[model samples]
Target: MSKTPAFNRRAFLGSAAALGATSVVMPSYAQQIDPYTGQPIVGATAGATPDAGAVQYDTHANQRHNISSFRAQDWRPYFDNLSNGAILCDLTSRAVHYWSEDETVYRLYPSSIPVSEDLTRTGRTEIIKKVEGPSWAPTPDMKKRNPEWPDFVGPGPDNPLGTHALWLSWQYYRIHGTHDTRKIGRKSSNGCIGLYNEHIKELFELSTVGTQVLLI
Candidate 1:
């Protein structure tokens, strides 16, 4: 940095002009906030609110930030696959986001749609295959604990597996139909992924026996 006279009026005017020009072309996708206070932020001169459709707090704790104030660009990251295209899971928010083969975004599902109450912190692999009249075999532990549940589970609208089950390849973790629709937007599951009954049914209708499923 070089020192200049504090009262350099010409220099100040030139710098202000450049800043004004830059702000005019700033993209909506960029997120900015006050460096000191965690409030909606823009440049020093004028405060700007975050763009709802663009910039979003990357994590529930706001540990990371993003910029998405302009255009129809997506701000979420995802995993790509040949059969499943790309998918994004916001674990903090419990939301599943899906995109097309071309990476054109499509749908967003609130987390409450499926919950895993018994979910442990350990991460593991799982398999998934669409099944009709899916039977939910309660673990011996679950049966011993939950005496209310029948010994042999059967498929129905109220079944825990609901109408469809995308059984996980990782043994027990499944993205399955939910009997409780009210819990869709919450972090309440028995360690298996859950989807709204209607949604799971739709996914079931769309998927074949060998349809590939991945958790991101």
Candidate 2:
């Protein structure tokens, strides 16, 4: 078996790949030095459109919907104003709100899917582990959704988990990176939250082992 490569925080920060700043819009206050790539990660202004050139993975996808139009009231109750390390994912808007210890609020796009008729059990969970360049394994349920899914895939740019993954306490759920950035801010994925590779890299640097996560 090929073991996942060791994650070296410092070495990753100084790596050459961390050079350029990304254009995704995270809260200005949430910007920080990427532990993976030493460059400062800056986000676009909230509500700004994703890069015009971002590829659309699904050729027959429906018309794109703007997250801003989604009602905030539907999920605001889940956000804890006093939390130092809590992540709130609004499945309706396909957005993730990360609250850091400094009280900084950053917005990230995550692909969402309507998993069940009743949304419970997903309300509160914590990150159990963090994996860098994680390998991919399709769950039985995932295979049922698409029988063509392979049993396994090695870690790399083409892997479904992209470059990093924050494993959630909730079984089989994760906040992770995606190979197709176009999936961000869209209704896709099985049930896990998906982030752009750069976004997840920044998130991986900021998140700890026990960060709280609320999905609504």
Candidate 3:
């Protein structure tokens, strides 16, 4: 008769531990959480934040920056219908959510929000205009605060509005792109919601002039 092999309990335990370690060794990005919601962020894209070393400390030295949440959202709680599609800007999350009218498309992007409550506005609005290579002009209030700022900046690298801009019904409010990639996922904008250039380009195409917008 063949000799029975002893059950190697220690070896079995060691193999189990190795398997557990392998399971836990997920990518760093996969383990990210939404700092605001305390929930695991799923399906977030690489564009949600700037690449490593992209964040500029010199420009925002004193500001407290928060990472944007990439968690997907449902539109029902915010909109009655997907009329012309809908866009939701969640200030607390520092993120923007978009849903197409026919429910065929949905996107979530990191955003730059107002630096302070006084500059922020919350309500329903609609995109009244869409401009590519949008020009930039300091609001009267903006000029009052930053006296040395240029009165106007045409569409270019220096333009704060970046490559595309979706003008909203409210004066001086827009959902636009920013050349300063560091601004995304941080509270750094004066009022407008800012997206990475690549992201806003996609969103600009996905949205139209009549797209509904809500900020909260």
Best by lDDT: 3
Local error of candidate 3 at 175, Å? 0.6
lDDT of 2 at 103: 62
lDDT of each: 0.43, 0.56, 0.68
lDDT of 3 by residue, 1-216 (tens): 999755342443244212311111122442254322345544422122221112111243343433323467899999999999999999887778899999999887767787667778999999999999988777777666656556667877656777999999998888988765555656666678988777789899999989999999
lDDT score, candidate 2: 0.56
Please provide TM-scores, in order, for all candidate models, with all chains considered together.
0.53, 0.63, 0.70
**Error in Å for residue 68 of model 2:** 2.4
**Model 2 RMSD in angstroms:** 14.0
Which is the better candidate, 2 or 3, if ranked by lDDT? Answer: 3
lDDT of 2 at 60: 43
lDDT (Cα, tens digit) per residue for candidate 1, span 21-80: 111222222224322244554433121211101111112223211122111224343333
- Candidate 2 lDDT by residue in tens digits, 1-216: 999756342343244123211223222332243222345544432211111112113334342545344322323466555344777777656656666766654444344433333322357888899999788777665556445445677787546777899999877778887655445655445567777677788888888888878876
* TM-score pick, better of 1 and 3: 3
**Where is model 3 poorest over a 10-residue stretch in terms of lDDT?**
17-26
What does the lDDT read for residue 147 in candidate 1? 50
User: Candidate 1, 66: how far from true, in Å?
Assistant: 17
RMSD for each of the candidates: 17.6, 14.0, 14.4
Any runs in candidate 2 off by more than 4 Å, and if so which?
Answer: 1-63, 70-76, 79-84, 104-107, 110-121
